[model samples]
Target: MLLASYKAIRPGMQGIANRLIRWRLDGDYSHNEVVFEPGDGVDHLMPDGTCEPDASGALWCASSVAWERLPATSPRRPGHRGGVRFKRIKLDPAHWDLVKYRRDPLAAAQHFKRREGALYDWQLILGFVAWLFRHKASRDTCSEVCTEAGGQLEGHRVDPCTLHQIVAAEDRHFRSLLWLAAAGEEAAY
Candidate 1:
C-alpha cells in the first residue's frame, strides 16, 4: 500500500530545523515522506521478504533527506551521500498524518524507488526560505519527491503543510488512512 506521511516538529535538537520551516512557512507539518508496505512491489527493500510495522505502528518510508544518517534501501549513487533513501521510521500517531493513495500503490512505489540516492535539493529548500537564494537543479527535496511520486500537486514546489492541505481537501485521490483517521473525523495533523 502507498501512504503520504507528514511529520510535525519534535522536541530538542531534532526539531530545530522543523521548527524553523514551520515558522517560515506557517505550516503545522515540517516534513513529508512516502510510506511503503511489503508485497507492494517493494519487496527488495523489506527484510526477509516481509515488512513489519514497529510498536507504534510505523513502517518503511522513502524520502529525500538532508543531514540524516539513515541507510538507503537502494542507493542510486553509492558514493554520494544525503539524498533519497528508504528508512524504517517509528511515527507517533499523534505527530504524524497519513494519507492513503487510492490508485496503484506499486506504480508510485516504483517511481519513488528510482529516485533513491538522488542528491538533496538544498538550493530549493533555501529558496523556500529566501526567494533570492532559490536555485533549481538535479536534486530532490522531501516534499517535491513525494508529491511527484504520488502524482499529487505535480510540477509544484510544495512544502509539508501545503501537501497535507491538498490531500486533506481532495478526497477522490487521497484519504486519511484508517489506522490514523478517527471514526468519521478529520485527521488532526
Candidate 2:
C-alpha cells in the first residue's frame, strides 16, 4: 500500500479520532509500520464520546490502513479532563521502494537530516532499528539507518553516545522552554 500525507485530519475509519498517526516500523520494511502525529476531529470525541469541543478540529488521513485498526486507551487516565487524541509517527517503507526512492540523493539527504538532528529523541534515533525500524539480522544494520535526508535508511550508522547527547541537549532545551512558557502564563506545545 502507498502511504500518502493528508493536509487535513479526520476521524480514523474505526470511529476513533486519530489524535496522532501511529507508525509501528521494523528494520526491514515500513509497510507494516505506524506513524503518529497531531490529529484533528479531536473535538468530536469526548472523554466518553459525548459533549463537544468549542469547535471541531480536522481529521487525520493516511494512505495506510483503516483507522479502526489503530490503537487506543480508554479514559486516557481519569480526572475526566480533556481527551488526548492521536499522534502521527514515521515508519519504515518497503525496501525496494527504499532503494528506488533513495536514488534521489537530494531527497534522501533531506530526509536523513531531519532525523539525524535534535528533532528526534536520542533513544528513538539510536534505537531506530530496534523498534519501528528494526532490520532483520539477515539484513545489514546500515540498512536500518540512512545518512540521507529522504531517509535512504540503509547502510548508515551513528554513534550511540552522540545520540544520547542529542537527546540530553534537547531535553534541557525543552525544559527551559517549558519553564519560560509557564512563567509567561501561556503553555507551549
Candidate 3:
C-alpha cells in the first residue's frame, strides 16, 4: 500500500512531516507497507482482543511507522513511540493506492514477521529532509521494509513514491488494484 500526502494538512493526515516528506522526496506518497494478509478468507484478531470477522475483510499490513496512534498489536521500542508495526486496515482508495506484487508470500511474511520490533530509521528519513548525514540504518523505514520484503536489494535508497514507479515499470512483478474512475463514476462501466 502507498499512502499519499498530496495535500497539506488534509483530514486524517498525521502532521506536517508527511508534506515535508513528499517535498523532500519529490513523491506523491510518503508511506508504504506490505500487506501480507489480504483478509479475504481468514478471520483477523483485532487489537482490542476481538476477532474481526473475515466476511468484512481487512488488509493486514506491516511497516515501520511514526504515526500518532500506533495499533495496539504493534511492538513498542523501549523509549520510542514508533517502530515496526502491524495494522489491520481497510483498503480504502481515499488513503491508499493498493499494489499487488507477484512474489513469494510466505518468504516475505516470514521476513517481516521477524522484524516486528525493529526501530524506525529516523536517521535515514532525516537524511532525505536535511540532505546531510547518511547513517548506517540499523533501523528500517516503511519503504525499506516493503521493498526488502519484495526482494528488492536496493530498498535502502528507495522511498514510497519511487517504489510505485519501480513497480509500475515492472509489469510482470506488480499490478495495481486501484480503479481510475471516481468512486461514484464506477457505475458508468
Candidate 4:
C-alpha cells in the first residue's frame, strides 16, 4: 500500500530563507509536501494528474498553495523557480494500522480543506529566531501541513528540514528516500 511521502523543493530563486534552511538542515530541500496519492502511468511521485485513492477514498491533498485539490502536477509557487526532489519513502506495510501511521496525509488533507484559502504562514520563516514565541495564527506552512497531516509535529515550530528529520527518526524503517526529479531529467529511483 502507498503511504504518505514527502517532497523537497529547490526553488531556483535561492532566496535567503531557502539557503538558510539548506544550510541549517545540511540538505537541499527547502519545502515539503504530503503525497495524498500516487500518480498513475507515471512514477507515483511525479507531479501528474493521477492521485490514487486509499481504502478511505480521499482525493484531496493538504496543499498550502492550491485552493482546491492538489494538481496532478506540482504547482509552481509564485516566486519559486527550482526543481523538486521527491523523497522515496518505503514504509513497512505492517505499520500501516498503527495509530501513528493512520493520522497523516489523510488527516492533513482534511485539515487543509477545512482551512482552505488560509494564508501561508510567512511568520514561520522566523521560527528559528522566535523559536520560543509560538505562532497562534490560523495559517499553515508547507512543512507544517505535512507534519500536522502526518500527526508528527506536536505544536512545535519546525522548518522543512526539521520535518524531514522528525519523520525519519519516528519511522526507523524509513529509507533515505531521495529521488531527484530535476528539470528535464527523468526521475531516478
Best-fitting candidate, measured by TM-score? Answer: 1
> How many clashing pairs per prediction, in order?
0, 56, 0, 8
Better of 1 and 2 by lDDT: 1
Residue-level error in angstroms, candidate 2, position 60: 15
Q: Which pairs clash in the backbone of model 3?
A: none
Error (Å) of candidate 4 at residue 179 is 24
Segments in model 2 whose C-alpha atoms lie over 4 Å from true places? 1-157, 186-189
What lDDT tens digits, residue by residue, belong to model 4 across residues 41-132? 22333333345543455433343531223232433332332222222223333312111233434355445445444556655556655676
TM-score of 4: 0.50
Error of 3 at 35 (Å): 1.3
What alpha-carbon RMSD in Å does predicted model 4 have with respect to the real structure?
Answer: 13.3
Candidate 2 per-residue lDDT, tens place, 1-189, comes to: 112222223444422222222222212222111111133222232223322222333222111122123224322222222212222333222212211121333343233223221111223333553555542322222122332222323323532223223334555677788888797885433
Which lDDT value does model 2 have at 15? 23
Error of 3 at 57 (Å): 2.8
Better of 3 and 4 by lDDT: 3
Q: How close is candidate 2 to the true structure, as a TM-score?
A: 0.22
RMSD of each: 6.6, 17.8, 7.4, 13.3
Error of 2 at 57 (Å): 24
Per-residue C-alpha lDDT of model 3 across residues 1-189, encoded as one tens digit per residue: 232222233445565777777878777787887665433222222233332424557656667786434555555553456777766656567766665555666556656656766877888887876778674556788888778877878677988888766765664333322343454478776
Residue-wise lDDT of candidate 1 within 12-59, one digit each (tens)? Answer: 865898888888888778888777765566666453344567667668
Residue 73 of model 2 has an lDDT of 32
Off by over 4 Å in 1: 2-7, 38-41, 44-48, 54-57, 70-72, 77-81, 152-156, 172-189
